[model samples]
Target: MLNMFNTALTALNANSTAIDVTGHNLANLNTSGYKAGTVSFEELVTQDLSVDSSDINGNGIGAPVLSRQFTNGTVQVTGGLLDAAISGNGFFTVQGSDGNTYYTRAGNFKLDDSGNLVTATGENVQGWMATNGVASPGGVPTNISIPPGSANAPVPSTFFGMNMNLNALGTVDGTNGTFTAPVEVVDSLGTKHTLTATFTKTDTNAWKYDISIDGGDVDGGTAGTPSSLATGTLTFDTNGKLTAPAADAGSVEISLPAFANGAGEQTVNWQLYDSAGASQVTQYGEASAVNSNSGDGSTAAQLTQVVMGDGGKVMAKYSNGTQKLVAVVALASIQNPDSLVAVGNNNYSTTPASGPVSYGEAGTGTRGGITANALESSNVDMARELTNIIIYQRSYQANARVITAGDEISQEILSLKR
Candidate 1:
């Protein structure tokens, strides 16, 4: 009877552990990025009533959520520029204040005061530093600042490149031969300028040209006359990104306007009339600038008018007139991600069971990068947890009943003596 009581006691202990796991799951059911765990059981040792006893039952199984080590949850997208989600096997590394590395799946990152990109808790995000413009593994963990597009900085850009299609009149009046068309030029601030490319037909399919910009003689902007192409060569790419780099590109160095709002800013002043054309300058509206980029104070502005080249794309441009690319966020994958041990503070620590971290840029390989303005939700199933609760409660009660029955039998034995 005493041995039976011991067996019941062990069952109670196992059931109690299972109940604790259930409580944890219930508590974290609404947690963001939380993964629900499941319980598993292994049988305890069994007694054999035979001439020669055989070892059986080993360690008895109880309800266990520990077996549900990880969960694959659904992700929600918000479409914000800074929001990102990881679609495959990897962990985001964050450095805690304690100087230890912590991992996470949360991608809700923003720029903190120190200009470092950080999580909601201000844990710094990591990235590869660029060496000579080549991104490599040596980048120190640094914060990325939120960029607020400010005033157009003063920088000179020569005729960078321009793409345009022309309609030839086929036959030029030998007596009075001339043709006119518009060509675009971007200034130091990436403002576009329309230069009137002119051709005095020397022959069919060919013309000698002089350029007038914003209707002003751009030939005057440069000391020499605008050079004209005599032979064949004026094709455009589909999306408008140049198929070949634009050459000879003389450049125009336009100065910035002296206004905060830049309300009346123009890519350039231009008007091309068929010969008797009035000298008119072209300027963009307020909505164009606002929609084109975030302002200096980080205002949310919608881009209304989109400027396109041969194709349509408004790539990032910096103060130096150098192209700036929205940095591609990195992602890390693990062969056995479940092996990762969850540390507190919404982070995890890597264990050997998780294997090595495989690094790659987002949206590449089997791993995919997520858009901004989206987040991953918890994987806890309330119904499943409730079922676990019932099983644990019943098991606890059954174990307790076993002990009670054992005590009752003991009482009967004593009564027999009495």
Candidate 2:
């Protein structure tokens, strides 16, 4: 009778614990990146009942053990630049304030005042910083920083291209027709200079062109006056296609003299051909007009915004209309994620049962791909939890009834003795 009472008590305790675990899951139904908690019950030691001691029956229910479900959560698009979600398996690695490494699935990150990316609890997000616009995934992970007022150095003009139409019906005499096209180029010191090209009809199928710069010196010429840089003749075939100065040899090399403002001399290659090795200048029977002009140079630019991209690449956009990779978010995968020790704040710490963490770049190996401007909703299913609540409630009541029945049987035996 006493053994029966003890068994019922143990069962009641286990059922109560199970109910509490279900309540916990219900509480975090809307929590971000929250994995549902499940309670598992195991049988306790059984006692031999027969005289031979070979046959045995269960003694009582054992304590319930709580573990995470580790199931994937629904991804919600939040449209926040730093918001991120894992589409498969992996956790975002962060360095906690306790100086211990922690992993989390919640990616609601923001830039701290010091420009380091951190979670709501202020843990530093780890990643690799890009150098020279290139990132190495195998590099060591460090705190990702996007300093305010960050600026990109100026890129001197190395190549310039223009598409234009040169009038084929212009008079052959140089005095009768001249066309001028101006292009903007940036020097090493980010100083803008206007390069003017003048074309004069010199023959029936040829035109002489002169490249010069204003308020500057060209090829070490005197400043404050137009200085000629290069002079060449462009010969077109009868079909109006450029035939002379073959595509490979159709580049103009010019040098700019040092400016008074301390800008260094800039050497630029003026490309006459486009990417397809075709002449940009056409000798068509139309009015002379510059259709488009482009150069590979820009003034110094300040950081405009930092955007998180798919595959965990953090890109910084500059005011000069350029984007560069700044960092790569790191991800960690464990053999048994459910065994990870939850240290609160939606973070998990490694345990012996969880196995070793496999660190890698997002979207690589068993890691999941990152989704920017989004977040993962909790995996908790409210309807399921509610049903579990009722089941556990019934279980608790049944165990309590068992204890009541055992007590009544003991009382009946006592009454007979009285």
Candidate 3:
């Protein structure tokens, strides 16, 4: 009888453990990025019973908490630049303001006071630093900012490449003759200058006059005569890469006026003057050009503004009206991601199990390139949790019933003895 009571007590304890495990799961059901725990039972081994090692195993006996169970949860989508989610097997590395490093799967981040990328709690985002094409891991990442008066310019080597399709039949009366546009150009010092081009119609199909850029121009022969820059015909191959210059090459090389400094991006005024008899104006927006049908084998983007592709790559315009690569963003990658330790707050740290960190771009390897204003969500499965809860409840009830029946039988035996 005493043995029976002990058996009942053990059953009660097991049931209680199941209840606690289920309760914990329910508590964290709504917790963000919480990996659900699994409660498993292991039967106690008894010397009297010769249990087969491979048959019953430990499934029939004791119940222990299995917190290490990893469930691929459902991810919730949130549109935010700071929100990030890992697609494969890695975690984000974070550094607290106190200089402590932590890791987690969560990727909610924001800009810190010093303009460094940081978490909501103000932890700094960790990654390798890049200068030019080379990169190295560092504690401080300089703020990414666009310099003021950046010299963003129009492209193509030969000036006045894309000439306006002049109306061969249209006539401009000298009384109201005008042609103007705001052209953005980089100066010898790499500064942005806005040049306002003015033109006057001189006669049919033929126009003449001075090209004043940013209010500056060279001697135009006689006071109002632009003999220095002679008028030229507009010729185009099927593909519009300009087959010819808009005006005749001058006796002296013409120096195209450009912006002043080279901090980064600049906006300029591009214009053409009609001094013949009529006035007209034109302007270019963010796009200098798109696709082009031209003699030059360059793509359409080369027809206007500088063209560029992904990463931190960009088409750079320099002083002296030149264009080149100004800057580019670098990406990094890793391996053995499963070994990464998860720190709270959606962060992860590389451990020995994870091996050495391998670097690559976002799209390279398992690290998918990032999308703006889009984030990966937590992987939590609600249906699975509900099912697990039901199983636990049944186990708890069975164990409680066993204990109650044992108590009744023990009472009957005690009464008989009395």
TM-score each candidate: 0.62, 0.90, 0.58
The TM-score, computed over Cα atoms with residue i paired to residue i, of candidate 1 is: 0.62
The numbered model that scores best in TM-score is 2
Which should have the higher lDDT, number 2 or number 3?
Answer: 2
The Cα error of candidate 2 at residue 251, in Å, is 2.9
Q: Candidate 3: where is the Cα deviation over 4 Å?
A: 1-25, 48-77, 97-100, 129-163, 170-178, 186-192, 198-210, 214-242, 246-343, 346-359, 408-418
lDDT tens digits, residues 320-384, model 2? 89888999999988898888988998999988888877778987888888999999999998988
Worst 10 residues of 3 by lDDT: 292-301
lDDT of 3 by residue, 1-418 (tens): 5555555556667767766766666676655545545556666744435764455422235656454334344445565534554444444555666677665445555555454556566776565543432444333323222233344333322233223433333336744345554444333332334334344555543444343443232222233333222233333333332233332321112355322223332222222323341222222211122121111111112212222223323233344444544322223344554544555455556667656654444455565443333334434456776677677678667767776887898789889977
**Which scores better on TM-score, 1 or 2?**
2
Clashes of each: 36, 0, 80
TM-score of 2: 0.90
